[model samples]
Target: MLGIKHNQHTNLYARKCNMKKHLSALVLAVAMILSAISGVLAEDITTCTDSNGIVYQLSEDSSYLILKNAINTTGPLTVPSEIEYEGKLYTVKEIASKAFCGSTATTITLPSTLTYVGDMAFAYCPQLTKVSFGRSKVALGNRVFAGSPNLAGITNYSGVEKIGYGVFDGTEWLRTKSISTVDSAVYLGKVLVAYFGNASSFNISTSCTSIAPNAFNGNTTLTSIDLSNVKSVGSSAFEDCINLSSVTFGNSLVEIGSYAFDGCSSLGGEITLSDTCEKLGAFAFSKTSVETADLSKTKIESIGNGTFKNCDYLNSVILPESTKHIGNYSFQGDSFLSDINAQNVLTIGYDAFRDCSILSDKEYFENVESVLSGAFDGTIIYEDVNGSALVIGKTLYKTEETEINLAVADGVKSISPYAFYAAETAQLLALPTSLESIDEKAFISLSDGTIFVFTKNEQVYSDLESLTSGTIYVPEGNTIENENVSVGYITGITITKNPVKTEYTYNENFDPTGIEIEVNTVLNGKESSYNISQIGYEPSYTYNFSASPIVTVSYCGYETTVITSIKFTSVPGDVNRDKNVTSDDILLLRKYIAGLVSEKEVDLIASDIDGTIGVNSDDLLLLRKVVAGLVSLK
Candidate 1:
């Protein structure tokens, strides 16, 4: 039981459309002005049924008729201005409210004598596309054509005077029309939906507060769009318009939807946003030819992801102090981006500056506090030491291609992560005696490179030992204790304890009759127990424990043991086990306190001996005291 309704107000858009004849042109005019103002009911009511079984409530005196409902079916309806009711001719003055509110009629033609269209009379007519309004049809009701998204072209609305609100509320016809002239501007209520006239550059009407999404999208002819009075621009509103060069924004625009100006490659002039713009949507100006995006005067708090991506010609960007974050890939592929002034930025997302190859080291780290990985991939870095190293700020990155016999420059105390990473050309690396610290992966991938140590300092060499490959060549007179390089025992090594022979022999037949094996700390997944009776021995055999790995041993069941060693990674109060405290221990302590030290680098419990809470200066001071012989681990 579907029905139709005509609301009490009319759509005042009147135009002569030159569409096909089968598609009837509708004329929606202002509501019943003459009769309502004059306070006159044209005729008395009478009921009648047409030959097609359609019911009509007619007025007897004025011959006015209202199609109330159809008995069998609704038609591509034709409402005549006059109809014979019980042989009495009645003039159809108006369609009553709810008369055809939800009718499925595909076409409707009104008579010239019709007037006073009632509230919601033709509302919710889904298939009611072709509609022809009579010259006398005047008044319209609210939502008269509401809920009809496909209601097609309407005809001349020249006779219209007062239009009601929401007449075409749910229709797509309102959004697809060209902007009409000032005398015939088409509007959805007060909102101007489209423009019909020819103008190279256009100004949105001051009467319109907002421009609908895709209103001017792909409109190639529109060169410049001035939105001085508009409050918001919808998503993709001006997208793909290659010729659109300039856009003038009003003070009222606060929110820009995503992809608003994407692919406007020829768009020129600086994208100087107003101070009122707080939210900038993703890809808002992506791939545009704008030379600069000076956001210093605006309130935009963050630059969205891929916002300026692939804009190869963008030379400079000025971010405001109000901006706190830069989204991922925001400035990626902006090859010409040489200047960026984000002095107040705190966090930069991954790949934000990737492929922005021209940005100098000074501009890259100006105000950046934390950088996600790959942020500077494929970017430029100045050589901190000419012909020696490619540098990011004061941190040494990698050496130049030609320098294989590396002499890490003096004053370079710390080797930054990935300093010599993947430099297969580097066959020999010579460390300076002044070198203080080297971060992880600083010497990674230099597997075949020979490390030359100028400093006899064991701690300095220890930091470099596990990080490099091949043999390390120490300077003449520099002693590398064999215990610093080997750890644990290969099978068949001899055990000599005090008060016994310097070399021990094993017999397979005796089950621990003379010698006993006691296990202590063992490397992960390595052997912890051994059957002494089955153990084979060699004369004067020895196991050099690298970093001094120690194990207790007994000969002939005596408790007196002769072997002694220390493991640097597991040793307490000896951060680097250089046999003495120096700047290395203090540096490790500081690194541990800074959350930059890994457990494999130092024993946590050994590092935090004071045991207050997290590692701090007090623990460092206590460790220094132990190093100074004021305290002991026991």
Candidate 2:
């Protein structure tokens, strides 16, 4: 029995040793698994310390830590414009390319010092709906928020002149949005045109005088304009605005620059021009397809070159009676510009009315005298006249043409050097025979068929007239010919040399008349003491200036205080040389002419008479005597 118990105890001891070994194996396996799990968790979010001993972020040492990375973290990242990590202020210059492509941002407010933004920096951020840029000009990088399915905000800063190419490439989910004024301010900073894709419409404020060039260009949604306060419209300010349909202006608007509404073919409104407006710049309303222009009260002074170049729909226009100037190519190539009623215009710039063919019945202005170079070069006026274009030789002219009663105003003596060459607009023209000269290129730039007409030098001074289609009567014995066409496309070309002709006859006649005067002095007293009581006389009236002077007149008891100042009645007189006189005297001319010659002058008519007696027949006699070389009158 003792031997059996010993054997059982040994078995129990063996079993305990086996249990201990199994427990050790289980603990070792569990420890290995726990270590692996811990390693995976730690690897999930990598970390890296910055140069300032502050941790930025990290996956791999070479990975970038931009504003929007691939990391999925609940974040409200604040990127300071000027980073002050340690002590130095470094610009957080770039949000690397495609950096924050799809970040979940509630609101993104940028700092002021930011300079560059990487392309598509904030693209496709579903939760990022609002963003505000500080003072710095924000360049809308390409595809910044392209696929943001729920994006709803639109920037309207005035400083961003150019919305970068494809800035909203895939922003298809935008809803319930209008451009913000801050965005407009940004656009202004960039001198960019205000487009209507983001903003439904636009009407410029009165305070804003000029719309920047290309300001509203390429905006298909631009519908209408109220230019009440706009005084000037810039070049190409609204080019290619397919949706622009109407336009109206206040009296304050004066000038419309080149390409003002070019390519705006949808326009269909009447532009009312106030008399207060003076100039219309190049292409002011060209390509607008305007139906009418109200110029009843217009007193336009100048029309810029190409002011209505391609506005083919307008057929009739009524210019003001005071219209004076037209710029180069003012109505060139306008297919429908049929009528013009320029009244007192003097100068028409180059190619003023080229290609205007349908204009047939045009007779409104009177006092028609001058036509500028290429004034009607390629218009129907140039193409239809039976003969050659009119010849108005070189020289700047002040007064322009009217429908009747021609008269050239001052500052203008002749036509432009190349006024009308090779132009065949008129077959016959009757010029003022009093016209002394015709300068070079006076008959240039015309069709080849027409001829210049003139009458006898003296007869032309008669009533001014023109034969619509008839014979041309040039000066006698003069060699004139149609200008050579070698000069490319020259119209109204007629070259005339200043030829010597028979001298004009003039007659002169003169008649002489004489007057004499003699004054008899029968003074009884050696010293005459007589008080002169004479009313004032005008400068035009004759005075006894060189009459003799007595020492003293008969002092018959101090006669009634002898008031020197008195109102006297008289006829009219000439004082100001305006050829008439009344109380409108300048008050000084009478004194200057009344024997008041200064001794410094040698040629003055000096008439010295004593004021001792009244101005009677004796004084008149003395004045006539002076005129008869008996005395001098100053």
Candidate 3:
């Protein structure tokens, strides 16, 4: 029995030892697997230096590698698209910032897989002369080749999209290539890199699709540029080109980068943009001399900050319906900018039109969702005679007076939003002929009994008709027929000057040769005049020599008559008072000359055959000769 118990204990101890051994083996295997994973992760995040002294590091996401630094690299360097390391293939996707800066590489070849070249990637590389980009499209960061004095050659950048500011500045390539007369400008494939020529005018190549930043910056000699085929203009492309007076933008142009034409003081005339242009960058035309900015044809949604700022000659700006915002200081300091049509604008930024002294249309901001501080600082404002109505620019902003006749000034072109909303007690509101538009809800608060008197402006009348439930009155014939409107000839007509010839014989037509008719009417409570012909004036009268006749002038359903004396007059040769000249008249003239009839009894003036002072024997002789048909009276 003791021997059997010993055997059982030995078996149990063996089983326990076997279990412990299995557990130890399992723990060792797990440690090895975790170590392998840790190694792999470390390797993925580590930097690698190749035999050629080029350094590279795995990207943050571990999908690709970035060429980090090539400072120790020498001779011609070729960056492969795929680099093999530890039996793994990784794509070289980017050239990191300053990767090749201060390197001794004489020539460099970039890989087709490269998507980005970071800022100053090849800067300060004095010995680097040539660079070849295998891929056409890449995002080039700022000053990529700046300070590379000997670098002069570049190839294959046609499809590049984003070019940072001063990419090729201070490079031998830009200095020599830009001044070369071969193309008159430095071009990186189809991209216009720079213009260093002395030409006063330049026409960009039709093949160029993009303009690099600072391409024409500070160029004093260039007066005009024709970019008819370019699609994009980079930031500061033409900044401070003070002498550049004319720029012909193409229909293909879609984007203008920030500060593109800033400080171009000589740029003048109307700026006509194509509908295809969708983006206008900040300070694009600031400090220019342009007279008008008619961007109504563009598809741009915003006017960027300082776009037309300090444009001394800019007088008019027509914003398109697509425009939703006006950025800060857009038209600020444009003293001559008197008006802008921004009916579709949703918001206006700070100082958008500040210091625009003549800007009068503050009504444009009435419906905007946001209007920042000082949007209209120095604009013109006018007050009515009674100080009840306030007008800004050509817009009637608001009125306070009630239960009285209100007449808007003649130059008020628009009625601002809610201009008359509080004037419910106003019985008569007269608008001038100069009114062009009435903003939404302009007359919403007016009562049904409030009468509106306005002249014939189709747009104003239509707008007013839609706003007010009150009665409208227009001049008789000038009325735009509408419901709840009264049309009566309140106009008056007066014959200011009668005809020069007032005397008329029997059965003669009354001539109005020298008639001066004045048609006067009350418009907006102010006396106004209309041309006689414009009022359809007609003159009507009957001729009667028996007494003074009345000449009546009719205009706009109004009539006025003028009375002038008309004396009875005889014919030149009627001596018998019978209105006939014959042998009897000659016998009567002879009797008058022979004293058979007194001078007063006969028609002495008529019997005078000659126009002498007195009728004597010469008159009788001429009368007898007249009877014989030998001679006639003078």
Backbone-clash count (model 1): 46
After aligning candidate 1 to the native by TM-score, how far in Å is the CA of 240 from where it should be?
1.8
TM-score of the candidate numbered 2? 0.38
Better candidate number, 2 or 3, judged by TM-score:
3
Better of 2 and 3 by lDDT: 3
lDDT of each: 0.58, 0.45, 0.72
TM-score of each: 0.39, 0.38, 0.50
List residue ranges in candidate 2 displaced over 4 A.
1-197, 203-209, 365-368, 372-374, 377-380, 388-439, 442-634
lDDT of 1 by residue, 423-524 (tens): 664454555454555655666665454454545466665666564335454544454443333223212223322322223211111122244332221222
Measured with C-alpha atoms, the lDDT of residue 483 in candidate 3 is 59
Cα error, candidate 2, residue 262 (Å): 1.8
The residue-by-residue lDDT of candidate 2 on 464-506, one tens digit each, is 1221232233433432332331111101111112112211111
lDDT ranking, best first:
3, 1, 2
- lDDT by residue (tens digit), candidate 3, 356-438: 88876556655454455456656663223143766554556666554435656656677666666566655555566667777
- Evaluate residue 183 in candidate 3 and report its C-alpha lDDT on the 0 to 100 scale: 54
| TM-score order of candidates, top first | 3, 1, 2
